[model samples]
Target: MTMNERIVQPQALLSLIALRDRALQAESLNALAFSMANDLYPVLHFHQALVFAQRGEALELLCVSGLSKPSEDSPYLVWLRRASRWVASQLPDQQPHWLARDAVEPPAEIAEGWAEWWPAGLWCVPLQRHDGQRLGLLLFLLEQPPAEGLQQALSGLWQTWAYCWAALTRQRRLRRWWPSRRQALLALAVAGALLLIPVRQTALAPAEIVSHQAQIISSPIDGVVERMQVRPNQPVEAGTPLFSLNETTLRSRAEVLSKEVAVADAELMAASQRAFDNPQSKGELTLLNGRALQRRAELAAVEAQLKRTQVLSPRAGVAVFSDPNDWLGKPVVTGERILLVADPAQPVMLIQLPVADAIALEPGAAVTLFLTAYPLQPLKGEILETSYQAKASDDGVVAYRLLASVEGKPEHARLGLHGTAKLYGERVLLGYYLLRRPLAALRAWTGW
Candidate 1:
């Protein structure tokens, strides 16, 4: 049917007005075109809708509706692909126009395919803003010519819908792109102010409860452990037997030395009598006296070794050691460390600050210890002393040793209790406090 043969009804404007409202409310250009397609379904009698957005010199497909998705190699899809670029260039005047298969010519490459599968008619509406800027194109493909009333209704609202679509496109572009200069400057100012806020600089390290004046129990003489008198963590008094070394060899050596001392005394006494009888024997008596004195000194040394056989606690405290079986059969050399008998009354926090995380620590610096057993109740303390050099800790981590004395003596505080310590240093900006390590790492990586 020809365009002149069709007639438009006067009441069709009401339906067109309702459709325009729906299109205006859409969030994006794609949604507006999709909604328009659905609203015009009964009116225009179209089978498929295609929406495209203009990008530089090309028209990019944004949305498609009404028809089932065609296969990649379908003849209809092949025709559409071949014709999209030609259709984009045809709408140069930013006006809505209809194309008839009889009037428009197809490209030579897909001419046969278009003739076989293409729709009978296509209406192209250029989406243009109020300022006449062409945003994109919307196409409705029909199997046959639409009624005159539907055609006139679509023509009347097409420009209004274009303006709505153009507005939607502008809103979307603004959201997707970067912020304006003013917005960026405002954000940077807020961040700078936050970074300038002062905060306490703190360093975290692994810590444990240790004795301030722990008495070390060492082996005075080399001997095998015969027995352990005190259990680990057991309370003990001064002079309490901690562990005993084998005394059998020491007692025998002392007895032999005693016998030699008696023999030397008898020889010296006989020599003295002879010296009195004869003046020539006086030199022999002096030599005998010297020998006796040497023997007596040897006996005293042996006796001293016998006395050290029984290891005793030097001060009254808790016996801090591992398993009792560990010390039972252990042989130790002279001056070898046996165990520690820590005075529970004087407890200090021993911090193991890892070498990688070490910070400048001074005496009396604030320290907060959070014991594993008593995690909620943090104990307050201050740095007492720090080792001059780093040493290997129990867990094989190279750490600096730091001693801190807790302020209040809590009843639950016990020696050997493990905890974490947060040592506070000088105040610094919040940015430095948070990014201190990251900055250090970046500097090391860049070497500047």
Candidate 2:
């Protein structure tokens, strides 16, 4: 039948409408390509269909009839691509037309495979938008030439498919550039929920195990440290000798005073014996007695000071100090700290919280100590005291000194064990906990 006569058929009209609806309803370009290759058989009779989409200046195979997806390396596809490129180059107008092997000669390589892979007739359809942008090309391999009426029908269908392709392509581009409103809202809700999660505000600071009620062992007299009676961390009993000041000077002075007292006593005795015979000697007797008493007082003071040269631990505990060599031959003034006699069982955590990292810490706040020596076994503690003012710590950072009592005195707890302490403050939102430092830095930079 003629093209005009066939276009008037109700059944063909309904089929065209149905096909257009299917193209319009396609969710993606791949789905539309599949329908174009596989679903178009009812509208047009063909041995096979190949779909190609324009990527750049070249047409790439999107799908093929009778296959879920086309393999690019397949011999059939390889030859088809070359043939399609030659055909596409011939059609500058980007129009749809039928092709035959003899009508337009393809390259020898493409022509050589035409008889083996394709049918006698081929139809080329260029899928273009209303704005003249070429979307892709469609090819149909037919055993016999299509009727004039079929060509006219396909032209109308091409227009509908091209329009749908353009719409779907724009939709895809939009989807790529921006998420759908529903998806964006859902993501925002998830992020808000995550930000609202409650977490404990915490900070990490350098810490060490120290004696809670340690005895301060200081030099009792001004002298050079003669010796350390006990080693560092060594256990000592009450009244155990801890250290001693140099007693050589004090001892010599005591000896001199003792001799002076002896001399004064001999002089006084001689004067008392002489006083029995002469009145002048009686007057010297009082001066000799006074001199003897002064010597005795000086001797007693020297003896007392000599006894103080040796220091002893007043309580049973461990001696916490640096190397004995550090103190040996070291001159120390009176009341200078020598070493600590600490109760190892009552170990406390001493934290040096840097001023920059200091948070709102309160008494009884949580503290977790991970000692360098025993990191695997963490000890829990609570803040017992916090320094009212920030001072330069041993490492020279201005920090607030915090003292925390260990919850359970573990076996590894001992004086002078160094570690890192994690101190926790009031709970806050997870967002705040994560952004606290960053926000602080931002505020410092922007002053906002």
Output the number of the TM-score-best candidate.
1
Error of 1 at 326 (Å): 0.4
TM-score of each: 0.62, 0.56
Model 2 bad stretches (over 4 Å): 1-176, 179-197, 266-291, 430-448
lDDT of 2 by residue, 90-138 (tens): 7757777778777777778878888788888788889887778899998
1-448: candidate 1 lDDT, tens digit per residue:
5433333444455666888788778876667766766677656667777877777777766666763333556666656765777877665587667787777776786566656655777788787677877777778887666555556656768877777877777787778778889999999999999999998888889999989989888898889999989888999999898888998888888889889989999998987888887988888887888889999999898888888888888889889888878878788899898789888889899999998887677999999999999999899988889998999998999999999998888976788788889989888899988888898999999999
Worst 10 residues of 1 by lDDT: 2-11
What are the candidates' C-alpha RMSDs? 8.0, 10.7
Scored by Cα lDDT, where does model 1 land? 0.80
Candidate-wise lDDT, in order:
0.80, 0.88
lDDT of 2: 0.88
- Model 2 earns a TM-score of 0.56
